[model samples]
Structures are given as C-alpha cells and as structure tokens.
Target: MDKTYLEINKQSWDEAAHRFFGRNPLPDYGPLAPSEDELNLFGDVTNLNVLEIGCGSGHSLRYMDQRNAGELWGLDLSKKQIEAAKTVLKNCHSPVHLFESPMEDNPGLPTNHFDIIFSIYALGWTTNLDKTFANVNQYLKKGGIFIFSWEHPIYNRVSNENSTLLFNKSYHEEGSYYHEAWSEPAVMQQYKISTYINTLINNGFKIERMIEDVRLTKEDIQRDSNRWYSYEKAKALPTSVIIKSQKL
Candidate 1:
C-alpha cells in the first residue's frame, strides 16, 4: 500500500547483506530448518518448474538448487535484494532467474508456465492482493502448487517489542501492521483467513493444507523471546501460518 515505504525497504535490503549473510556467504539453517522442512509437503521438486516470490537475498534460491527442481525463478520488488542475490550466485551455475518486479505485474513470463510457486513472509507486504493472487494463478501450470508462510494476521495487531501480551479484536480487519526489523519499517496487511482462502479458490486454486502454529524452538525462547517473539504468548496463540495450495 505504501510504495514509498516499500521503496525504502528495497534500498535497506540491498545494504543489509553484510548484516544478513556476514562472513558466511550462505545462510546456516538453524531455526530456519524447521521452516524449510515444510517445503517437503509440496511434494517432489525434481523437474518441476518453481518460482519464489520475494526471494530475499536468494537464500531460498540456494535452497531450491538442492531440490533439483527444473528452471527456478525468483521475483522481488527490491532490485537491491536482487542485485545482492545475483552476487551470491556468481559462481553457482543454477537455473535460477532472479528478477526485480512486482509480483502482480511480473514481465517476460508467460502464463501457465510454472509448476510450483512459493513465497515466504512476503505476500502480505504487497499493495494489491487480488492482482497478486491472479498473477500467481497466471504463472502456474495446471495442478501446480502454491505455498507461502506469513506473519499470522493475529500477530499483526500488536507491534510492541516491550509491550506485554493482551487480547485484541477479532481476527478480521483491514489495516496496516507495523514492525521494526533490521532497522527497516516492515508493514503487513490484515486480511481474514477466509479472505485469503477465498481469494485462492476464486482464482481456481484449492487449499491442500494449512498450518497455523506458534511452535518455537528453545533457542527462540531463550535468545529472542522478548524482542522477536514471546514464548508465553506464542504458546497461547499462533504467530505464523503456512499454507500449501494447488491450482485447479
């Protein structure tokens, strides 16, 4: 919704690779391992065309290479992120296409050309949901898969790192949820669970599986509990939701 704000994010992401990847050019899957493991539910990737929307820093791009999937493409609104991602892929001869484009208006890609599309924690940041969903549908081949993980709509209500947990309104609303991450303003859009499910269904996609959980690791509880997440609150409620869907 905020193009200028998102543009700021684009610039920030490009400049943060030193902070993100650091001495390790590749990311080490610590807590992220659990999240990455969820990709298995989408089934085998061998020879299947795949696209990763919001492929920040190309960490997912590197992960996709291990899947042996057919041609892989990653699209993001941040050209800075894409530039850093390309740098990360300098020596790796993989079939990965990294592009700087809005997901809703991606260029040079034909419709019904991909077998799987996956985005992580990035879809809700888009300005337009309907057009985004339509674009997802347009790119997937029949029976292709679409999966994404995002900050739970409930988690969007409160942005306080120091604020204690408190009950909020019903989990349906239209507004901006703000958070400070990597010193950049992260904004999320609120949508009911049904709105997300219906958007996919209306676009000729069927939900294959959905998981809403607050399962946190011991490390997450110990190190980043107060700042990034709350152990007690997460145990009481979900913080993230990951969904897998199939094009009908």
Candidate 2:
C-alpha cells in the first residue's frame, strides 16, 4: 500500500486515540503540560500567539489556554486526533483554532505572525525538512521561539540495531539520511543530519538549546522487553534531543 508518514501517524493515532486522550486530557510525547521550566524555553508567552504542529490531543493547547495566551492554534495530519482535541477543548475557557495540514503543506497561517511555534516527535517523520522548516519560519514573528523535540539520531540508530551493541538494520555508511515508514513496501529514502540543521539556520532560526538524553525508565525498558534496543547503550547515547531555537 502506498502511504506517507502522515498516513501512518493518522492510523496509529486513530487506533490509540482513546488510550491516549484517556490517559491525559492533553497528551504529547513530552510533558503533559507546559510548565515553568518549559515556559522558560520561550522566554515569555503570557499573551503571545502560539502555534503547535502535530498537536495530537491538545495537551499543549489546554496548557496555553490556561495561561490565557492571546490565541492558541493547532495543526495535525489526523482528523481523528483533531476531533479528540476538540472534545478536550470543550472544558477550556480560551478559544482554540484547529487545522488539518501536513507540515510539508502550507499551513495557511500569516507569515511573521506567531510568537511561538513548537512540535514534539513530529519532525522525525517529515519527508522534506527544508520545506517544513521554511514554512515554519514564514509563520513566526521576529525573535519568536521554536521549540521541538525529536527522536535522537543516536537513539534512532541504536533502535534500528537488534541489540544496543549490534544493528538490526544497516544504515548508510556514508552518512546519508533515511526516512522509513512502518507499513507495506517499506522504502527508505536518503536524507542528512546536516540538512536538518542547515534547514533551520537557512530558514532564519538559531539554535539556543540542544539537549540529548537516553531517558528511559525501568517501566519503559520492561514494556519493550529489553531486547529491542540496547537501553544500556542508550544510557551512554541519547534517545532524544529537545531543541529550543529562535527565529532571527
């Protein structure tokens, strides 16, 4: 079956939507709500406009709503997720705008318009980094914050390994990047780490914070059966990286 990353996300999210939204009113891969520490990532957003990509069930949306932010909006590729988010938003006092769009597609928000744009564990699935980040830049105000998190390259590499010490699948030896989907006729496409970073800088974003960690709990290991990736090795290498940047 011919499928894109968004399609895969939609399917998985649709199946898991109940479990996801049930666990938390708003759920993202990261913290349930934007805390003071997370707020630090964006300096100040008391009344600033916020845009979130891949906002599965409006976890961040509810958080921003509580803060009484100027305007809160979210975009995701999954209609089911959008529906789940709207249901959650019913209790929210602030207004929220939702849109269905893939990151590679134009999001239709005004350029230089948002105070913050953030995503978590979403960019890793993107087919085009340049187009994605470039479009993100178009929506941000000058000096706006862009905070996101992704599967750490190291973690991705290790996860592909059968063991922490050995690879389950071989990656390009020449440093070529690859994008892989979960479903049928699995094909991997070439990409590059440099391309991702360059895409940000080239799109007028400057990296301010880059945090990498292995970050698996004992439960996480048990849940995975400990045979998947070398969690022990991941202890030494990072499984994810959280980045805080600014539109310069």
Candidate 3:
C-alpha cells in the first residue's frame, strides 16, 4: 500500500474538514461534479441498509438517513472529518454509525450486512483499488449495489491551471499526483477506465451502469460553477465518472 501518500492525503483532508463541513450541510444531495442525481442510482433506499465510504463530515450519510434508510454507516480515514461528522449527525438526531479508517482496512465492518455501499469523489484517493473493492464486497449483501463517482481519468490528465488539454503523464499511469485544491497539496490516484471496471469484476461485482459525466447543458455548468473551472473550461472536458454495480 502507498502508506506515505495516503498519510499525506489524510492530513490534507483533516485540515480541510472544518471548511468543507461548513460549506456542506447535512442532507445536501447535490451532485459531486456530474449533473446526475447519484441518490437516484440507489432507486429508493427506504428501509435499506447503506454504507458510505470516505464519507466526509457525514453529509451523504445524513442524506440517506433523511431518505428513511434502515441503517446508516459511514467510514473515513481522517479523525477530524469523523469528528465533524459526529457533530452533524448528533445535531440532526441521526443515529449514524461512523468509523475512522482507510477503505482498505475494512474497519471490522460486518459481512453481508449492507444493502448498498457507495462513495462520491472519494475512491480516487485510495492507493489500492482492488483491496478497497474487495472489502466493499465483503460488507455488501449479494445483489447489493456499489455506487461511486470520482475524477475522470481523462479529465485528470489535463493540467488544472490552464485549459490546454495536454497530458504531462500517461492516461494509464497509476500513482499519486498532487494538486493545490486545498491549503495543503492533495494526492489522488489515476487509473484508466478499464482498470476500474476490471477491478470491480475481480471483486465479484457486475457492472450495471458506467457514466462518463461531461458538461451537458447550461444548468450543468451553472450547478458546477463553484468548482475551480469556468463554464467554458468545464464544457471542454469531462468532469467526472460514475459507476453503479451490483455484487454477484
């Protein structure tokens, strides 16, 4: 495992937790980057057990709670992020189970317990996608869903500072890359689309849907206006990718 890179990224998340939690209130189901409603991917989570991986400050968990999910669990690598999540869940009177651990660690979660396991813009930070997906498979019930979204591999290829669609690295490169999105440098892993799909298949998941979410309409750009890119820039590139799969 890339322990050093993971630690650096974890610290970055810990430091940004306060500001991120402040900006995003509980039950905020706005799209992570793509215009698609990720919540709808679950097709009605009412009375279903759900777990969210890398759930920063528990906003997404609280959203599941609001949808009347049977049980809610969230796991994160940053202690500070879990601390803020605890506060948010407490204030909302939500009985959410929160754990602080990397996705690869499994965090001693129960097997075949969750009806759905999901993440948004989080899995990209993981150093070992195979282990993470395998751990998720252990916790999810047979036929249960695994939904996640992350920075598109092609999108990550371009330089963030300028609109030039030039790649300093190969699209198939798999390692840590630093970005100045936060006060401290943030590290994320880049993998090709085939790698993601193959990893899911090896972990006993059947690909149900794969979406390369590009800027579609004026509303899409406006919805993502708060991001680092402008309307024209966003329109010129694919912003994110979402996958919805089921455990076999």
C-alpha TM-score for every candidate: 0.83, 0.76, 0.88
Off by over 4 Å in 3: 22-39, 91-94, 160-164, 215-219
Worst 10 residues of 1 by lDDT: 23-32
Tell me the lDDT of model 3 at 194: 93
In terms of TM-score, which candidate is strongest?
3
lDDT of 3 by residue, 133-199 (tens): 9999999999999988876777656665554556667887776678767788787887888999999
Better of 2 and 3 by lDDT: 3
* Candidate 1 runs further than 4 Å off: 1-39, 158-164, 168-170, 177-186, 219-226
Query: Candidate 3, residue 36: CA error in Å?
Result: 5.2
TM-score of 1: 0.83
Per-residue error (Å), model 3, residue 132: 0.3
| lDDT score of residue 99 within candidate 3 | 94
Cα deviation at 206, candidate 2, in Å, is 1.3
lDDT of 1 at 55: 74
Q: Over all chains combined, what TM-score does candidate 3 have?
A: 0.88
Clashes of 2: 6
